[model samples]
Target chain A: MLDVKAEAAEHSGAGAPGEEAPPLVVEGLGHAFGERQALRNVSFRLNRGDRTMLLGLNGAGKTTLFSLITRLYNHRSGSIRIFGFEIKDKPSEALARLGVVFQLATLDLELSVAQNLLYHAALHGLPRREAAVRLKREIERVGLTDRLREHARTLSGGQRRRVEIARALVHQPKLLLLDEPTVGLDVASRQFLLDHVRMLCNEGGIAALWATHLIDEVDSGARVIVLHHGQILAEGPVPEVIRRANASSMREAFDKLTGERSE
Target chain B: MRPIHYARCLRGIIWREALRFINQRGRFLAALVRPLVWLLIFATGFRFVLGVSIIPPYQTYIPYQVYIAPGLIGMILMFQGMQSSLSMVWDRETGSMRTLLVSPLPRWYLLTSKLIAAVIVSVLQAYVFLFIAYFWGVHPPRLGYLTVLPALILAGMMLSGLGLFLSSVIRQLENFAGVMNFVIFPMFFASSALYPLWTVKQANLKLYYICMANPFTHAVELIRFALYEKFNLEAFAVVGGSLVIFMTLAILGYDPGRGLIARRAGTE
Candidate 1:
């Protein structure tokens, strides 16, 4: 499965080979605001076709780390690389392979769904004809094919999020970074989103880093990185992390790890 | 990125701006009404009070309405520029600006595209105002209209660049009202838009110098001369120089590593 999608990505010119570097790499990433350190010594690597859950409580620097990775905020003390291209040095090459669904909904409410998606596709330099085809395919994937002409404001919250996911995929990015993508979502909507993204990673060979504070979202088969107070408390396969914390489930493991640090 | 990519991105940004402008019926009305009020009522009321000598652009004595038509056009461009700035701030607050920022293109190219989009909208608005003014007996030479296009574009670029610079520094949508009072109003009132420089010179030498120093004044002068099929070298130089300066500063202000975004990153 991985090889099939990897070959597709290579042919599509989405993945640039750089000594076969991983999809994403963060090394000694540190960021501070005046006197308050928001993120400290954050280091991780996400390989192709990997699904990693970045689990943390509120104020654990999840958003800050995402911001640096997205290049929304500059990282002064560390480095971030995408496909072996450093973010600061070769942002165009680095960001070309990245797709992001931010926590906040960024759609222009006045524009139709298709318009919003096409605008994003153009930003990624896709030709108009190709963008239109991808727009149809991606929106169909999210089950919004019938709502293409509807204004974004007319869509419900769940529908809006699905469109955002479709927009992120229109460029055929190799790595998808979703920051609390399921926040404020209903149970059904959340499950649909979680499943859709995981399926994309598994079948398309697109590396994904899903950040969330919700424990139920992390499956046992997934790798987990537990962050607490701007530091990583544990990182491994979900079951291994649970075993290391001496807890039976992810919830207990997370509580135990964060609880010990708070004391 | 290829040149084709840049061209497509520019087309997309401008198309988006045009679509937004078309959708906001109230915004279109407001842009026209503000300038029309000055032409129909304000200029009419002051027609006799503000007597005009035969200026270089004016071959003979003209009514205040005709004299101020270009000023009203300048007003449209300035207000549209400020409106673009307000929308930028709103986009930032709503997180749509992040969508643009995270694109694979260079930051400077993205910002320049945005500025060009804004200038295109402002110029369209200016032409609409000029068309209305034509029916109001504010006719310039037929060739004047064609000549004014370049001036309107240059002046629009300068004003929009100013707005773009202001948008980068203004942190919040709420703070934009302060900019209206502190920047827009002052710029409009202290320029040659409403009155001639000589009139202000007679009133106060210091005020005249202030007007001379004001970039808005030069923008108004540029538009005034272009409306008469002439060019003011000084005004052209000043407006062009201001466009370069403002555009450079606006680009720097949006730079992720060394700009205002870096300073505010911790808070976000």
Candidate 2:
């Protein structure tokens, strides 16, 4: 929808040799809430241009892991690095390259769509002129240019999610993290979002980690991390995981790996 | 991050606060009405019962309405401070706080910017109250109008610090109503807000001691003296010291690694 080719060309030859570290890397990440462990020894990596799906059920610690990696909750037992910058020691550097679409709606309902996008851009330290340009471009790409002046409350669920996706891209982050972004969307909206994110990874060279519990959302060739009970049960391509789980379909593989039947 | 980036961040936060205030027309009306009701009805009824005396800020005996104007200003700031904290709790529940916390800026800077924005809104409300009280036959010295600003800022910051600390400890929105009754009412009533501290001393010694120990009492005295273009060194010292303590505790309370947030990350 955007000038993806031009933007991709701009970033194509930027990184030097040996400077292209994976967009994200988590090592032995563990987190807890008092006596309850939320995430334990979770590890993963996302290379440039990779669109990895982090598949987990409710309370499977997917949100907990995202919180730790996003630095919303501090991790005590492990480390998270973004583009070679450790989150604990170099938070600013690490967070600057991250774009997140939280599970809950975070838009200020009183503020217009453009205002919300501009506020996010300012938070990421974008210059006023640059922020305005990106705000316009991103809103246009999301097909909401005419609705820019409308308050977030006026938009439908799908439109709000699209606006959020556009907001996340305003700062041009290197790593995008979405936690159940399509939870309540319609069939078309869900497909649109999934395709848009995949396009970003394929054309714009941005790496993404999409967290979802829906089994049908995963593509057969894409890398996936199946999490269960605060631990990753499987990691690899879909076919490899299904085969390793001694199942014929992704749904069966997930049920077998998590030791639960799908209702 | 560059200094310019920090400035941009501050501007954005302040702008959002201003926009939210403008959008919430009912909140602004309520902020003004709460103080006005006290100035108009409560003070009018108490005028006959309460006798005025010559205080440091008062050269001669003043009417009950004039005597209570500064207290009402302090009331505006305190109520607004608490109101802002309520919004913070709401923000956390609604998930907007997560967006703010995940920003690249340091947590301290973000929290401070929030405090400063709240203070600006409260100060604006205070000035509007002062303006309305002017037509109601209550007038401080002309210079008092100009001098009361810094005093309001200091008092606003202190009250907001208390508010921020409360918001960090508060778990649910339902608990905030309990806090308003326990924390707000006691602080307002036990202080020298309604009557002079000397009057409280004459009536009950124990109440006078509690009033003296209350930070809200110093905040009231600070505003009371500053509105008359005079300085109260004691009130100034107490308010400033309390501000430091409250702000430090609030910053720690919101800290992710060590404070209450770390203990219970469920709500935050």
Candidate 3:
């Protein structure tokens, strides 16, 4: 059982109808390597109708947590339930419900857009017609309809990121896990990606766990899971956590929570 | 799950790897060239001095080229396994491995899909080598040709498993060349590829047992036995036994916490 009392207080004001099953959930999760305690009894939840951005410093176990949730690597102790299924015992079924855009460019550079989509679709076991229909929508949504014939490697950084997002949605997964999706994008592209994510949560009710370290990317209203030393230092709406830390902004809250200001 | 989907996934993985190789035309040529040299040049030169024997599957005495067809096929599986696996290591270094590792599919299935694809491509390439041998006057099994399917699959599984194991542990392609030299060549030479195991006893008995210990020898033996339209029980055991060990290590090598993926070790 996770102590969500503080979290509930912060998020209780959001009138999002009911508290639907969070798209992603981590409970009492912990991990370590040799002498390094990577994650310590971490626990949190994110709803599908809500946008939750994971905030953490470098080596604060941000990627490690994402790796565990995406089932990229193993967690030492704890349970990670995505859409109500544990990753360890029911990986295939549970994982099938997940769409992930890793921090690195996972696209095969030489493959054409259509070819890449088909490959991913087949791999995810999506029906041909349904995959095609969704593929069209996703491509146009990302404004990449014209570049569908181009190779992934030839596209600009922003275009490649867009393609990665489109590729992740080809299966219409209930949960989307993005690891710092807009890291290197220019101003326009970053805004474009953020806007697309907002649409995903608002229109499709698709839950997303958007991992990032930037405060600007964390919208004023979205839930924030602040990670410090591989542990959850704070959670819930961005504004409340800032108020709790008695800080002026989310960055100030983060610095105080992680002991940076104390130092 | 419809079996067709699994079939489709298998095809997609296979197609990607194959197409990638096709895009790298130079690699394809080199893949073909390596075997051609072993068959036309090395085997041909040794054919006279190979000391012909009534090796089973060979109903009557035959030329060394005829005897080594299956071995040549074995070579294809082994090299292709290494080549794809080398790419896997490179993919990890370049950060693409993380992309596939995160796919919702079971890690084993994702890996099996890759191994299966590599096997198919290697099998097709093996057939091309077989056709060339046929034209070169090398006598191959007539009805025994059909058995090549299982033989090739078994061979592919074995080599791919080996390559997977190699990829998990070996960090860089630069270190891989040494691994190939030390592990691959000996496995190929000591096996019943160029010479029969029993014959090896006449020249060197200790060396014969070492070859017998190699799983690759069994892979070669399995293909070699199938080549003659005769079932060799020992070949079956060798191939099966190697598969067991290779798959076990392959799985362990790729294991998240203890294996290469987590440890970031070059080769396991």
List per-prediction Cα lDDT, in the order shown.
0.86, 0.85, 0.77
> Which 10 residues in a row give candidate 3 chain A its minimum summed lDDT?
A12-21
Better of 1 and 2 by DockQ: 1
Off by over 4 Å in 1: A1-19, A260-263, B92-94, B172-175
Q: Show the lowest summed lDDT stretch of 10 residues, model 1 chain A.
A: A6-15
lDDT of 3 by residue, A32-136 (tens): 666778889999877656788998877778887887787656778988876667787767766777888888777888677766787788787666787788888
Model 1 residue B170 distance off true place after TM-score fit, in angstroms: 2.8
Structure candidate 3, residue pairs in collision = B169-B266, B169-B267, B169-B268, B170-B266, B170-B267, B171-B266
* Order by DockQ, highest first: 1, 2, 3
Put down candidate 1 lDDT per residue, A120-200, tens digits, no spaces. 988888899999999999999999999999999999888999999999999988889999998988999999998998888
For each candidate, what TM-score against the reference?
0.94, 0.94, 0.87
Per-residue C-alpha lDDT of model 1 across residues B1-268, encoded as one tens digit per residue: 7999888888888888888888886878787998899999999999999998888788999999998888888888888887785576566434668888878999889888888888888888888888898898898999998899999999988988888888777666356577778888888889988888899999999999999999999999999999899999999999999999999998888887874876666666
Docking class of 1: medium
For candidate 3, lDDT tens digit of each residue in B1-268?
4666677667777778776767677776678888888888887888889767786767788887777878888888898887776676576433556655655565677788888877777887888888788876776668777876788888788888888887776654466577678777888898887788888887898998898887888788788877666677887877777776777787777766554565652112
Model 3: residues with Cα > 4 Å off, grouped in runs: A1-20, A261-263, B1-8, B15-26, B47-49, B59-63, B93-105, B169-175, B252-268
Clashes in model 1: which pairs?
none
Interface RMSD of each: 1.6, 2.0, 3.4
Clash pairs detected, candidate 2? none
